[model samples]
Target chain A: MALEANYGMVGDFYTQNFTTTHTGDGDTLILNLGPQHPSTHGVLRVVVELDGEYVKKAEPVLGYIHRMHEKMGEVKTYLQYLPNMGRVDYLHALGWNWAYVGAVEKLMGIEVPERAEFIRVITCELNRISSHLLWWGAYLLDLGAFTPILYAFADRERIMDILQMVTGSRLTYCYYRFGGVSADIGEKFISDLRAFLAQFKARIPMFHELVTGNMILRGRCVDIGVLPVEMCRRYGATGPVLRGSGVAYDVRRFEPYSVYDQLDFDVPVGKAGDAMDRYDVRVAEMVQSVRIIEQALDKLPEGPFLNPDLPDRFIPEPGEVYYSVEGARGKIGVYIVSDGSPKPYRLKLRSPSFSNLSLFAELSQGTLLGDAISIMGSLDLVIPEIDR
Target chain B: MATLGQTIKSLWSMVVGMKVTGIEFFKPKLTVHYPRKEVDNLGTYRGHCDLVAREDDPLTPKCIMCGICVDNCPSGCLSLTMHVVGEGKPRPAGGAGELMLAQEVILPGSIKKAPPTGKAERVLDSFRLNYNYCSLCGLCVQNCPVSSLAWSREAYLVGRSRQEFEFDLLARLRAKAASSQGVKAA
Candidate 1:
């Protein structure tokens, strides 16, 4: 109705797909997984033509949760759109913010100080842990386990409290300025963070004992929705999903932005790239995050929180840059095109969830209905991140 | 032979997970009583923005209408106009003037105010702030030469109409002054 009557939406919607081609086949039955179904997650609708619970053909319909973040970035200034970055993925909020800001800084040649860099790394790692924790809980909940969600939330609240002290806001923090951070970290902030680290370390082993080795969880996840190592790279899957497929690639190690080069941490990988491998990789990654946070705290430097000499209005030289960071879900990146203006000429967010979700078509094909939801949970799709 | 060994390894891991969840099922719940027990650390960053007083010098920063704060403002929320009582014809502040010095003068402080050294150096007669476009990024507070401006912790700034978002900067100053006077009287 909004468009010219002559103009119409096309491609996947209008075209006759594989299910329709094989519509008369006696073995296949078509099933719509959602535009409202809980298992599909968010407003995602998957039209799965099934052959007795085995997905014969899966066509995922997008644009239901589309708020058009890229379009909004065109209208707003650099500082004006900082709040909208948080809306992209509220769970991995800090990670997306870090990637967006990191890209702009790179393009503009803004040098973040050692102290600010360390703080960024510490906060980013902590947020990664929080994101994974939520995923762990939600994955279990999707698999018919409710108690773990409450357990995960308890741990997540501790991380939120620590972040709130320095950032001021809880969910969406516009803490990172163009050059550096907004506020200085106090003595209380460090001590409180240290306490969280200790508690988190003690609790991690318990997670493995509770969920990792559970008979039911193992039975459900192990060898289910197996994505081969080749498929992970071909589809550009990231974070634990890529790591689970035995890829040693990590953006932090590869690019070395912020203080990531100074810090020492290991990337956890798995041999078989199954649902269980994804789950195990995430659990291990959380433990690794705790290690990184502890290292960052010990090496915390005393200096100016923000570069005091930065000009009020920032205009980067006309250039395009692709900067990425290992976020909770995957490698969140920003493809920024600057035309020597305070506002971006074109800002395209390369959302990891969007790329990670593309693997669904290949992986979900042979999996059962119940196992499909398990695979989706294991992938940990942040809907807004993909929509953005 | 390899398949059997792999199956045994999987079984062992399953047993480990069971041990952990089983232990949690017995542990006492660490739930908080929301209504009865209130957390004291709710507004940790609140009430930090108080007008810093320079007691020794009376002329330090009472209020001077040098629009440094107004100029640097991202939201364009501040407007300031000054009136000078000089030994000249009564007119607007920016008009031609050879001023006679008064005993007391409103000078813009270091935070939100800058020293008004010009001929039109005097108290702020009027001020305005359009809060509609203000996302409260705290750039205004940081840029204020004299620290008179602030965001209140009472962040319920949502209003039904656009007019409600526009605040009278002078009115807020007056209210603050009146409250201070009341406190002193008490």
Candidate 2:
């Protein structure tokens, strides 16, 4: 029987709305996967048309957590908007912070000091490793391996301690200011980071042994949800997602922001564009992140943390600039239009999760409902970032 | 024979996974016994922004009631009312009150004058900080001219309700002043 409901009623609007309808004759079932489900990673609603266990069609309904950050940029001054960047992608906030700061600096032609550049490189890379660790744990949790996350958090807590020494806050960090970082990295920060690096290096082998080499994990991830390089390019997927598709296009390597050009780090690429390949790419990327941090620490220079000439209330010249940084998930771009005012004329955050999650509806077709969850996990969709 | 070999390889992979778990089992436990045990917080751990008292006079806050922090606060969590001391009234004694008397008065005509009778002085009446809305961005602390705002080391700060988080800086200053006076007297 057709589940009949009043067309005009508020709650029945989704069911009664004119679109693809599956009556009793057609056995296809329409399922709402979230807006609250733990696997969606945040408040993300995925409406999937299911043909038995396989997904026939899928559509992601966003804007549940949308705060209209673009509108906020128009209203708030440049300095006021810094906190919002961290809140956008809490996992890889430093990337977003770098993107926005880099854009403004480019627009205003501000030269960041040598010491500040090195600090940015070190802190941002550390944040990237922390983000990847969380993703590793959460993804494994989604795949029904709970203990890995406990181990992941154990390492993550130490990194957070190191980050907290410099950034002040553990999550949603607003460490980076207009010209440079808010505070200088002390001796404690450097020593803690070195200790963390040593311990993390020893832990990586065990992570590979426990999760990566597992037969069950390989079975679930190996041939499922293949995202081709062409599809990734079309969808504007960058970072690990693009690398997982065998594209070695890392923004740090290609564009070279802050002190990334000075640092030596290899971009890890996967051969096959499957979930397992994506997983391998991220795990490999973590090792590369550690290498980058070590190089940055060795080359750390001495200078003023913030630009002396930069005023407290900074107003950039009337121009437009788009700055992109390679975040944990993908490329985070901040496009700012300045009208020679303290407030931005228009600020648009080209968050990576938005672009990466856009390819999901296309990728999940004809795949088992279970595989769809794995694909979503691999994507590392920060829903607030997507909705922002 | 090929299928059997594949099964053997899968079993070996499972063993590899189990080996990792077994090693972890023997390793020292990472979990901390919460409430009983606590991790040490670094000096950089920012809890909440608190008003800093003057080094010379422990009771007096270094804040000049300039309202720069109040204006610059992005979240609008900080608020302070300026109390204008009426002419001929005896200046309130003690730290914050004494500082109010010493506060320089700037007239609209670009004239700077010291506090006396018939001269209106700006004093911090009540500094209200809504900690609930505070992002703890440290912008206010960084911007304070006299360095009156500092990150409080109160890491274990908790409140039952939203109203409890609304802190009155002036009252805190007064309480601090009284406590220090008691200590000095004793």
Candidate 1 TM-score, true structure as reference: 0.81
Task: Mark the 10 consecutive residues where model 1 chain B has the least summed lDDT.
Answer: B95-104
List candidate 1 segments past 4 Å from native: A1-29, B1-31, B45-145, B155-186
- Of candidate 2 chain A, the 10-residue stretch with the lowest lDDT total is A1-10
For all predicted structures, in order, the TM-scores are 0.81, 0.90
- For residues A1-388, write the lDDT of model 2, one tens digit per residue: 1334443343442453314354334677888999888899889999888889999878888889999888888877677678888999999999899999999899988888889989999999899999999999999999999889988999999988889988889999989887888999989889889988998999999899887888889888998989999999899998888899899998889988888888888999998899999999999999999999999999998999988788645678899999999999988899999999777899999989999999999999899999999999999899989988
lDDT of each: 0.73, 0.83
Relative to the real complex, the DockQ score for model 2 comes to 0.36
Question: Worst ten-residue run, lDDT, model 1 chain A?
Answer: A2-11
- Per-residue C-alpha lDDT of model 1 across residues B1-186, encoded as one tens digit per residue: 999998888788767766676877898876767657655554544322223233553223344444544544433455556666644332332211212111111122322334545554365566666665554455545555555555455433466998886666666656666677789799
Give lDDT: candidate 2, residue B103.
31
Model 1 interface root-mean-square deviation: 9.5
Clashes of 2: 0
